[model samples]
Target: MSVSPQDVEKVALLARLAISESDLPEVTERFGRVLGLVDELNTIDTETVVPMSNPHDMHQRLRPDAVTRQNDRENLMASAPAQDQGYFLVPKVID
Candidate 1:
């Protein structure tokens, strides 16, 4: 769980952080504390604990899947500036 100055430097490089030489000792100590906490958590017994997808046991209510709107494509296409074969046409802007 102990973190070295080099490890802190590597972490800073990976995170794209601008860490000064003076800050290395403090950063390394903080990282060491975090690693120690994680190491402590690994010692807990979870053999009887069940994994959960959600904290609460509940099912989501869903409405029946059915089309509710009438087909109005013909009325909609009449307002388009330019349309061809049921698709709106536009000028090519890219090569």
Candidate 2:
């Protein structure tokens, strides 16, 4: 599980990265170690394990779906430039 300097150079070219000649060796070594760790993880048997949506067992609390407030129409109409029948009026944008 190792990547060559040529492999790293080709990858850098494809990824649009500017890697110097000196950095190629370090990048190749790092990528090889990453591939090795991935190889190690491939040894695990997860066929019998149950998939989880979250690591911690927690649920969100929600309020009851009921009306809890009412709008003060007179107070709201006072702030508008023009209002008619408890509604704010705006300039017509289209016919």
lDDT of 1 by residue, 1-95 (tens): 78889988988899999889888888889999999999998899878988768888877789889998898999989989999999988987698
What lDDT score goes with residue 7 in model 2? Answer: 90
Full-model lDDT, candidate 2: 0.87
Runs in model 1 lying further than 4 Å from the true structure = 51-95
* lDDT by residue (tens digit), candidate 2, 1-95: 87899998888999999999888889899999999999998799979989778898887789999998798788757878898877678998796
For each candidate, the alpha-carbon lDDT, in order, equals 0.89, 0.87
TM-score of each candidate structure, all chains considered together: 0.51, 0.47
Q: What lDDT is reached at residue 50 by model 2? A: 91
In model 2, the worst 10-residue window by lDDT is 71-80
